[model samples]
Target: MSQRVRGVISRAKGAPVELTEIVVPDPGPGEAVVAIQACGVCHTDLHYREGGINDDYPFLLGHEAAGVVEQVGPGVTEVAPGDFVVLNWRAVCGQCRACRRGRPWYCFATHNAVQKMTLTDGTELSPALGIGAFAEKTLVAAGQCTKVDPAARPAAVGLLGCGVMAGIGAAVNTGGVTRGDSVAVIGCGGVGDGAIAGAALVGATTIIAVDTSAEKLAIAKRFGATHTVNAAATDVVTEIQKLTGGFGADVVIEAVGRPETYKQAFYARDLAGTVVLVGVPTPDMTIELPLLDVFGRGGALKSSWYGDCLPTRDFPLLTDLYLQGRLDLDAFVTEEIRLDQVEEAFEKMHGGTVLRSVVVF
Candidate 1:
């Protein structure tokens, strides 16, 4: 049976999102319906509102979420009704070339619900990142539901479905941060802080966090940054080098998608060190680096999509760490708001007043 639920929707580009009734159809083949418990307001939701992602108007706007699996359709075996899960955007297709090569994280063919969730007027809604989870209930491919510990707070764990995971994955997976390594993370937002925490989790001895805001820098310290560089007050590159014994960091994770930060990450790493770009860059933005420097750098310059995470492997591991009090996932949740407060949450996000304002249903 179909369920009618209240959800946040962006009717058009540059318009405010509205809480409206959306009809979620029953799970189709290889799909499942989730009773969303909590969802995080991510920057991607705002991008969807601004039409920066695509021309899919009247979009169902939330993606980073955790919920209970309410039902499953045909051929679903990974999860069952009543399972608590974090919804992920990537539902890897094992047949993709990336998956064929055993790199499922780069799977070119991820899956979503074969059916659509439509408006009352019968117009189809493009779900943000294929999870449209700001609503009380959401439909997704069965593979999107990665079951985790129910004891963990839904609001906190839900964040792992997106930004938090991206940041952590950037450092551990893409940046290859290791014990005693010197790592610097540019931009101390939720994502950057996650990178710092991930570095610390892996025993990185020198963790430097660079951000324009002193408030965010303070927050970074709580997340395991050994040092903080206020970009607004000092030269980021120089400050990072100074903190690392005149040598740049071994791994520099760029969480702020601007070209300036990208360049900072490039020059702020040691010779043969990795630079991981996890921040989403705009289309008009481009970076130009000296070709000679690119050759001399002699290391990996990689971009992380969803932190290059394999949700099934990473989500459960992180949840266990969080449960053991080793990972402070709760620090990422600044406030919990109701669904109607999404716009206000977005404003707080824009003002950098909160790491994340989660919507709890």
Candidate 2:
């Protein structure tokens, strides 16, 4: 029997999402159904509504989430019913080329639930990031459920499902930030702040945060940024360099995903320093830099996919950190609202007054 549950769905391009009934089938082989406790309203969901991600309309929007497993199908052993878990988009297929190469983080064959959730009329829904979670219940591949300590707050740890993981992984996993390394994050939003927190977790000595908003910069400081650079008031690259003893930071993370911020990140790193871009850029956006500068800089430039994370590997560890008081995951939750307030949350997202507005079931 299919479970009829309320979920948030975007029926058309630029249309406001509707909280309507969806038919969620019991998990098929290797699948699991989750009872969502909390789901975050991420910018990516808004992008999907604007037709930025694709023309896949009537999209089931929401990805970052944490919940309890309600059911599991045959062959599903990763998580059992009643287990608390964080949902992840990348359910790595071990047979994929990337997985075979021992770098499952780059897995080319990630997966979702084989059975589709549908509108009451039977129209299939495309889940955001293949893990649509803005619902009372969501179905996903069993591998998509990463078991974590249940002691952590759902609204806080659910952030690991997306932006937070992206930001933290960009620094620790991709940028290889370490003790005594100087780091600069060129955006002060959720992801950039995650990078700052990750840098602090790893003991980065000089962490500089750059942004146009003083409010965001101040928040970044709480997340472990040792210095702040107000891009609106000064040259971002110069400010980062000034904070790093006239030598640019050892690592620069571009979280804004804009050409200007990308350039700023490029120029704000020390020679041979790594540049990690965790921000999602539009296809129309492009960057142009001097060829000699590119050659002379002589450092790695890499893009972070979900912070290059291995969910099973990272989520549990990070949750432990949060529980231990070593990581301040609670700071990310700006406000908590009901399922119906997602549109209002999106509006607040534009206002930049909140880091995250989470949906609590």
Candidate 3:
């Protein structure tokens, strides 16, 4: 039987999200239904509402979530009912070339439930990142549900589903910040701070946080940033280079997906150092770097897709770290809001105070 539940939806572009009744169908083969415990409000969700992601209207509006498995359909064996799980958008296909090449993290074909969540009027809804988690329940590919410590707080662990994971992965995985490396992170938001934390966790000798806001800079320190640079007050590349002993940081992570910031990241890294771009850029956004500089800078410039993470591998590990008081995932939960407060959360997103406004069920 289909389940009718209240959910938040973006009916059209640039319009406020509405809480409405939605129909969640029973899990089909390879699918599972999850009862959401908490979902984080992310920038991607805002992008979906503003017609930034695509022309997919009537969009289901949440993705970063943690929940419990409620039911499983035929052929679904990855998760069982009552299992505590974190929902991931990328469910890697084992048969994909990337997986067969021993890099499942770069899986080309991710999985999602074949069934559609719908509005009460029978109109189908596009689940944000293929996990419509704003509702009481959501249907997803069984592989999307990664089991973790059942004792973990849903609000904190859920963040691993997206932004935090992206940031940490940008530093640990993509940037490959090793011990004694000097790292600089641009944009001291959730993602940037996660990079800082990841750098500190791996013993980066010097971690510089660059941001326009003083408050965010201070927060970055808590995440293990040894130094702060006000990009507004100083030239980013110069400041980063000065902080890294006049050479440049060994790794520069750009969390703000803007061309200008990316250019700063490009120049802020030491020769042969990696520059990891974890920021999500709009389709219209483009960068034109001098071909000479590209040739002169003999380093890898990489984009981190979902932090180059394998959910099954990273989520549970991070959850355990959180439970052990090693990773402060709780700090990312600025406040917990109800489902009805999503619109207000979106309004405050740019206010810079809240790291994340999570909907706690």
Candidate 1 structure, TM-score to reference = 0.99
Q: Which pairs clash inside model 1?
A: none
Rate residue 321 of model 3 by lDDT. 90
> What tens-digit string does per-residue lDDT give for candidate 3 at 6-97?
99999998999999999999999999999999999998999999999888789998999999999999998888999999999999999989
- Clashes within 3 Å, all models in order: 0, 0, 0
lDDT of 2 by residue, 1-361 (tens): 7899999999898888899999999999999999999999999999999999999878999999999999999998899999999999999999998999999999999998998999999999999999899999999999999999999899999999999999999999999999999999998899999999999999999999988999999999999998898999999888888888898999999999999899989988999999999999999998899999999998989999999999999999999999999999999999999999998998898889999999999
Give the alpha-carbon lDDT of every model.
Answer: 0.95, 0.95, 0.94
Off by over 4 Å in 2: none
Q: What's model 3's lDDT at 315?
A: 95
Whole-model lDDT, candidate 3? 0.94
lDDT for position 331 in model 2 = 98
Per residue, candidate 1 scores C-alpha lDDT tens digits across 58-149 of 89999999999999999999999999999999999999899999999999999999899998889999999999999999999999999999
